[model samples]
Each structure stands twice: as structure tokens, then as C-alpha cells.
Target: MFDLDRWIEIFQTLSKNKLRTVLSGFTIAFAILLFTLLFGIGNGLKHTFEEQFKGDAQNSIYIRSGRTTKPYKGLQSGRRIQFRNEDSKFMNDKFSEKIQFFSPNIERFNVQAIYKGEQNSYTVRGVYPDYQALEEAVMEQGRFLSVLDIKNKAKVVAIGRLVEKDLYGQLSALGKNITLGGISYKVIGVFSDPGGDNDERFIYTPFTTAQGIYKPNDEVDRYGLTFNPSLSVDQALSFSNLLTKLLKEKHNVDPRDQRAIRVQNYAEGTKNVEQFMGVLNIIILFIGIGTLVAGIIGISNIMVYIVKERTKELGIRKALGATPKSIIGMIMMESIFVTALAGYAGLLLGVFTLNALGDSLEKYFILNPSVETYVVVGATIILIIAGTVAGYIPAKRAARIKPIVALNDE
Candidate 1:
């Protein structure tokens, strides 16, 4: 099967038509290059979308109160809806199995934080221990708020990395006091957020402490919940809808009023994004395969031309006792070699391009864009099959050449 002499003959034939061979090879190479680049870019887009979901739990849902848009149950429209600690407790008690984590968020705007005579204005929030996981906060030092802190209304603060740096400036803030709204609270922890520096400008305290200090009564700004991982997106959405309905009923808001109880289903958002990416991948594949089909057609046409030009030589070989199978094998081998070599060049170029831009692209949320090894192997197989098929009809024509007829052709 390994015929060195036959390979040498095939190379000689290809070398004789240098321009034609180069053009044919270029077509195949360009097609593969386009396919690789499009696929890599599609993957990059997917990575960018995924990075946006990193700041929160994938299945998390947020519930916030808004002004009523329609009157219901004798209540007038335009009534501002508000949530309290009782509502959070009721939801936690009622949906214990369905919920993974729940936190009632209480926000105070433009709060002054003073530490060692250095003061800066930042938004302050009161949250529970579960808010740590819900917000995907990474503790850089000390510990986050605990259940005991909330129960006892402890005057302890967990500051963000930005807040710590602004107020303390490289010095350890733990066990140190910070005056928030004129109330002295000991620093307990410092945290970093996936959402970058903007998210690190807020400080967190125990919900009870915030309620006591801010005197917003029992009112909370919003509620955050993450569903159990075992639930599907549809299932989680159904649960969110049920919760919304229950809240509307409990708060005496209109059942059909959408604005009274606003719920953000992160699971649904993520699912929609994934569906969009699926469509994007399909579009990329369609265009890539279309380019490859054109290249294959070009290879087929060139092989036919090669056969036509070498009809007399093929006939001479037949007359000299060469078998039809050997002639077909020679033609097919040439087609395969040209395609494989060009494909390798395209693959190498695509990989090198991705590697060169990987670092720069990461700043835009695109991680390493690469084709898997198995996909590359599969593409190589496809190239070989395509090369053989492209040459098949031409090789058969060469095999059927009659020595007498071919010798007479000018």
C-alpha cells in the first residue's frame, strides 16, 4: 500500500502545474481557515455571555416592590408596595424545600463611613449570611455576617474591598471601629465581588442592625433567592410565578398588576442567552460548511481537469500493464495530499491567531477560544473523505481511458 514510486510520480505531476496546484490548495486552505475562525469567534461570544452570569448564582431570582399600577381589593392605584421582614420569614417558611438561599436586602443610600479620621461616602446594605452566596461574594479577610449577628443586632460590619481600601488604606480594618451614620461598628470582614470594583463600593451589616439604625421600620428594599440546583429552568420559573401570585394576594395588590411585584428570574435570562448561543453556533457551522462545500467542488473540478490533461499518459500506463485500481489510487492520493496539507496550514494559522489574541480578548470577557482536540480529529477525517470523493469521478474516468482512443487525442 505504501508505494514510494507512485508517490514520486504523483508529486511530479502536481509540480508540473504549479499555478493550478497552488490555486486549488489555496481554495481549500481558505475555506478551512474561515471555518476555524468563525467557530472560534462563536465560542468567544459564548464565553463573554457566560462571564456576565458570574456575579450571581445562575438560578437566583430577585424580587423588588414597586408602585401599584392598578387598584385592587378596594386599594387605590399608585400605592407604593413595600416588603418587610415578616414577608421574608413567611416565604422562607412556606418554600423551604424549593429555596436554596434567601436574603432580605435593605439599602441605605450615600452613607458616610468614617475610619480613623478618614471618611468616604458609599451605599450601605443590610444582608444575611445567605446573601454571601447569593451575591457570589468572595471573602478576602475575616468572616461575613453570621446568623448570630442578625439575631443579636450586632454592631459589626463586613466591608467591601474598595470600602476597606478607601477607609483604611492597606492597614488591617478587622477589629477596628468604623462610624456608619454616627453609629460605631467594629469591622468584621472584607470581601471582593465578581462584578469588579463597582460592586466593591458597598458595605454590609446585619439586617436587624440596619433596620434599627436606619429606622426604616421593618421594611426591606428587596428580596433575593436562589432556587435548588435540581430544579429545571421551567420549574424554577413556575415557582417564581407562584411566589409572585402569593405575594400579590398577601399584599392586597391587583393579581394582574405586573408592576406591583417585580421579579427577575435569572434562570430564565440564562436559558434565553444559551438558546441564542445555540442559534449562533448553528449559523456559524452553516456558513463554515458552505465554504468547505465550495472548496470541495473546486477540488473536484481541478481533479477532472488534471485527468483530462493526462489522458494520453494514463492510457500509456494502462497499455504498459498498470491496473485500473492503481491509477484510481494515484489520483485519489494526490487529491488527499493536497487537501490535507492545505488543511493543516489553515488549522495552524487559526490556532496561532487565537493564541496571539487570547490575552487581549479576555479583557472583553472572551476567554481562550479554541476547538477541542476531538473536533480537530473529526475535521481531519472529513477532509480525507472529502478529498477521496472529489477525485472519485475523475479517477474513474482516468481508469476507463482506452489506449487506442487516448493516443489519437491531440
Candidate 2:
């Protein structure tokens, strides 16, 4: 299979027609390059979407009440809807099987926190022990809030990773005393959240303690819960819809009102994201196929032109005892070699460019774009095969041309 003489002939022919060789190579190379870049960028866009949703539990749902914009059933417009402890009991009783984890959230912003000489303003939330799971927080030190802490109305707080960093510095915040709003509390845990810096700056306390201290009348700011993980996205969405409708009815709010009782379901967002990602995958596949098709056409045209230009040379060889098979084989070998080499060069360049453009395209919502080696290599192999097939058509016709006719015509 390793024909040194045949390869030498190919090399001589290629060197003699440098322009033809470069033209053929560039066609395939540019196609592969464009294909690689497009595929990499598509993957990067997917990564961005995944990153955005990674901040929260995929199955979590949040409920927040706001001022109603429309009047309903004798109630005036602009009525402020309030969530309460009774609402928590209502959800647990109504959807016991569908709810996995639930927490009534009462948040305080700009809360002044002091740990010895360190002082900062951080967000403070009052939530049940299940709030940890709802927020998808991981305990970095000590432990998260416990049922016993809530039951005892313990003056214990679980601070965020950044909260500890800002106040306690390198020293551990666990089991230390931290003062918040002129009230002293023992630090029981330090947790980190995937939601990034904003989430990691929060301090959490027992719902009972905060409700008693801040709102003794039993008012809740919002509700956070995760649906049962076994539920499908559609089922989760239905559950949230029913929950929102029921909450609105319980509060005597307008059913058509958008702002009265808002249910923010991650499932709905996930369904939309899945649909988008599906479309994105289809688009990427289309672009890749289109790029490959264009490359094939370009290389095919160039191969035909190369054969046409070498018509006289092929005829002279045939007259000099060159077999038709040898003539076709030489042309095919030359075309395939150039195609494979150029395609690989283009692939490497595209990959290197993606690596160099890493993170720089994040502002464009493209994260660490890259292409798999097998994908690009497969494309290159396909181009080489196309070149060989394309070259064979013209080579076969040239092989049939009579030497006398070819020589007289030229």
C-alpha cells in the first residue's frame, strides 16, 4: 500500500500546480474550520444556560405575594397580599404528597452583623430547617439549622460562606457568637450556595425566632419549597398552577391578577430551557451538516478543475504505458492526501482559537466553547473520502480519453 514511486509522482504533480493544490486545500480547510467554530460556540451557549439554572434546585418553587393591580369580589385595587403561617399549614395539608420540602421565608435586608471587631450588612432570612434543601445550600462548616433549633426558638444563626469571610476572616464562624441587629446569636453553621456571591452573603435563623422578634403578628414574606423529585416537569408545573390558584382563592384575590400571588416554578423555566436546548441542538446539527456539504461541493469543483488542467499530462502518461487504474489512483491519492492534511490543520486551528477565546466570550453568554476531537476527525475523514470520490469521476473520464485526441486538442 505504501507506493514510494506513486507518492513521489503525486508530490511532483502537486508541486508543479501549487495554486491548484492550495485552492483545493483551502476549500476543505475553511469548511472544517467554520464547522468546528460553530459547533464549539453552540456547546458554549448550552453551558451558559446550564450555569444559569445551576444556581437553584432544579425542582424548587417559590411563592411571593405582591400588591394586587385589579379589584376582585368587593376588594379594592392595590391591596397588599400577605403570606402567613396559616398559608404554610394550608399547603402542607393540601399537597402533602406533592411537597417534598417547604419553608416560610421572612427575609430582612441591610441587617447589621458584628462578629467581634468585624462588622457588615448582610441579608438575614428566617426559615425552617428544610430551607437548606430548598436553597440547595451545602454546609461548609458545622451544620445547618435543625428541627430542635426551631422548636426551641434557639438564638442560633447559620451564616453564609461570604458572611463568615467578611466577619470572621480566616477564623471559623462555627460555634461562635455573632451579633445581629443589637441581638446576640450563636453561629451554628457556615454554608455555601451555588447561587454565587449574592447567595453566599446571607445569614439564616430559625423561622420561629425571627417571626417572634421581627413580626410577632405571624407574617411571612414568601414561601420556598421543592416539589417531589419524582414528579415530571409537566406534573410539577401543574402542581404549581393549582397551588397558585388555591392560594389566590384562599386570599380572596382576583384569579386573573398576575401580581397578587406569584408562583415562581423552576419546572416551568426548565421546560422552556429544555425546549430551547432542543431547538439549539437542531440548529447546530443543521449548521454542521451545511458546512460539510459546502466543503464537499467546493472540493469537488476544485478536483474537477485539477483533473481538467492535467488532461494532457494524463494522456501522455497513458501513452507511456500507464494503466487507467494507475492514472485514477494517482489523482485520488493526491486529492485525499491534501484533503486530510488541510482538514486537520483547519481543525487544530479552530480548536486552538476556541481555547484562546475561552471565558472572553462569557459576556456573550458563551462559556468555554470547544469541539470534540472525534467529531472534527470524523469530518476530516469524510472530506478526504469525498475528495477521493470527486477526483475519481474526472480521473475516470480522463483515463478514457485517447492520447491522440488529448494531444491534438491541447
* TM-scores of the candidates in the order shown: 0.86, 0.88
**Per-residue alpha-carbon lDDT of candidate 1 for residues 1-410, written as tens digits (9 for 90 to 100):** 68889889989988898987898788777777777777787788888888778788898999999999998878899999989888988999889999999899889989988987799999989988899998899999999999999999999999999998998998988889999888899999999999788889889999888888775588889999999999998999999999999999999998889999999999888889979988998898888778777877777787788778888888888899988999898888888898899888878887788878886888766777776555554565676678788787877977887888877766
| Residue 12 of model 1, lDDT score | 95
Query: lDDT of all the models against the reference?
Result: 0.86, 0.92
**C-alpha RMSD between model 2 and the true structure:** 2.7
Colliding pairs, model 1: none
Cα lDDT tens digits for candidate 2, 141-259 = 99989999999999999999999999989899888999999999999999999989999999999999999999898999999999999999999999999999999999999999999
Clashes (backbone N, CA, C under 3 Å), per candidate, total 0, 0
In terms of lDDT, model 1 sits at 0.86
* TM-score, prediction 2: 0.88
TM-score (C-alpha, index-matched) for candidate 1 = 0.86
